[model samples]
Target: MSAFDGVKVAVLLFVAAIAQVSIFGQLHVFGAVPDILLVTLVAISLLRGSVAGAVGGFFAGLIVDTASLGTLGLTSLVLTLSGFWIGRYGETTGRDRAHAPYLSIAVVTVLYELGLLVVHFVLGESAPAGAVVRSLLPAVVLNLIVTGPVYGLVRRLLRAMERQELSAEVQLLG
Candidate 1:
């Protein structure tokens, strides 16, 4: 990716992180807040590759951790893994799939919540498995609901870079 592309992604994630903590974080529906940052990260990962996803995940997660004054590096770890795996999926079997975004969002939402629970347990914090399980369906639903528009916007924003990346992948294959 070009320097400009990197800057654009950074700015995008920065805005996403800020909005996530400030706005979406406050709005609760069905006792669950929509994870806009996670959806945005997934969209970027689906367009970019593992490295970009990992970096973007870390950047966004750090912003979230800082903004919320929560445990440092907690979100970073989970989101980094989530982004990398999603990016790999995009690079491999999910690139052209119509349901990639929806599938990724649904699966990652579950995994992200489970990951947080596990981490909290390990750290002797309040795990609250019951609450997480109760909220899982709603969170996944909310994320999937936003996936179409978020993915479209992200894909549109990164269209040039995505084309370049796809051409490079094709050339590599041939």
Candidate 2:
């Protein structure tokens, strides 16, 4: 990507961070907080790549770490891995199927929670299994529900950009 793409990504990440911190977390849907950053990281990874995903995860995690007052790299590490996995998912699987994003988010959501639980354990903070389950399951379901629309919007932007690039390439060739 050129500087333009890089800047776009950074702006989106910043917006996502701000939204996650100021907007999403505070919005209680019957006491269920939206995992806006996590979902954004997931979308970024799928739309971008593993490196982008990892970077997004790292920064997002740093924000969470700072906000929550937990260990510095806990969220950074977990979200980085999640982004990496999603990027890998994008590479390994073709995106022709309509069901892919929803399914992928559903599976990745559980794994992300488990990874966070492990991080908490390593950090010497013990959470009851029930608490972990409670926090994770709802977040996963909500993410799955939200993934479809988000993916559609992201994919459309990507496709439009690709078309522009393709047109430029054709013109150069001619």
Candidate 3:
């Protein structure tokens, strides 16, 4: 990625982190808040690559942790994993798939929640697995619902980078 591309992604993640904490944090639909940051991170990972995803995840997660005043590094770990795996998925099989965004959102939403629960349990924190599971469906639905718009916007924003990456990959294959 170019320096400009990196800057663009940083700005995007920063805006997403802010929106997530300030706006979506307060909006509860069906007893579940939509994870705009996660969805945005997924979009970035799918568009960029594993390294970009992991880095963006860590940066965004740190911003979120600071903004929400939650346990530092907790979100960073989870998001970094999510971003790397999803970016790998994109690099291998998901980039050309139309359902990639929706599928990624659904699957990651489930895993993200469970991962958080597991981490909390490990940390001896209150890990309400039952409540998290109960709310899982709604959160997944909410995330999937927003996937279309978010992915589209992200793709559009990163169109130039996508073209560059594709050409580079094609040359490598050739």
Q: For model 3, what is the alpha-carbon lDDT of residue 126?
A: 100
List the candidates' TM-scores in order. Answer: 0.93, 0.84, 0.93
Query: In model 1, which runs have C-alpha deviations exceeding 4 angstroms?
Result: 164-174
Strongest candidate by lDDT? 3
Cα lDDT, all candidates: 0.93, 0.74, 0.94
Q: How far is candidate 1 from the true structure (C-alpha RMSD, Å)?
A: 2.5
- Per-residue alpha-carbon lDDT of candidate 3 for residues 111-167, written as tens digits (9 for 90 to 100): 999999999999999998889999999999999988889888988999987688789
Ranking 2 against 3 by lDDT, winner: 3
Clashing pairs in 2: none
Q: Which window of 10 residues has the lowest lDDT sum in candidate 1?
A: 1-10
Instruction: Put down candidate 1 lDDT per residue, 63-158, tens digits, no spaces.
Output: 999999999999999999999999999999998999999999999999999998999999999999999999999999999998999899888888
lDDT score of residue 74 within candidate 1: 94
Poorest lDDT segment (10 consecutive residues) of candidate 2: 27-36
Q: What RMSD, rounded to one decimal, does every model reach?
A: 2.5, 2.4, 2.2
What residue pairs clash in candidate 3, if any at all? none
Alpha carbon deviation, residue 51, candidate 3 (Å): 0.5
Which is the better candidate, 1 or 3, if ranked by lDDT? 3
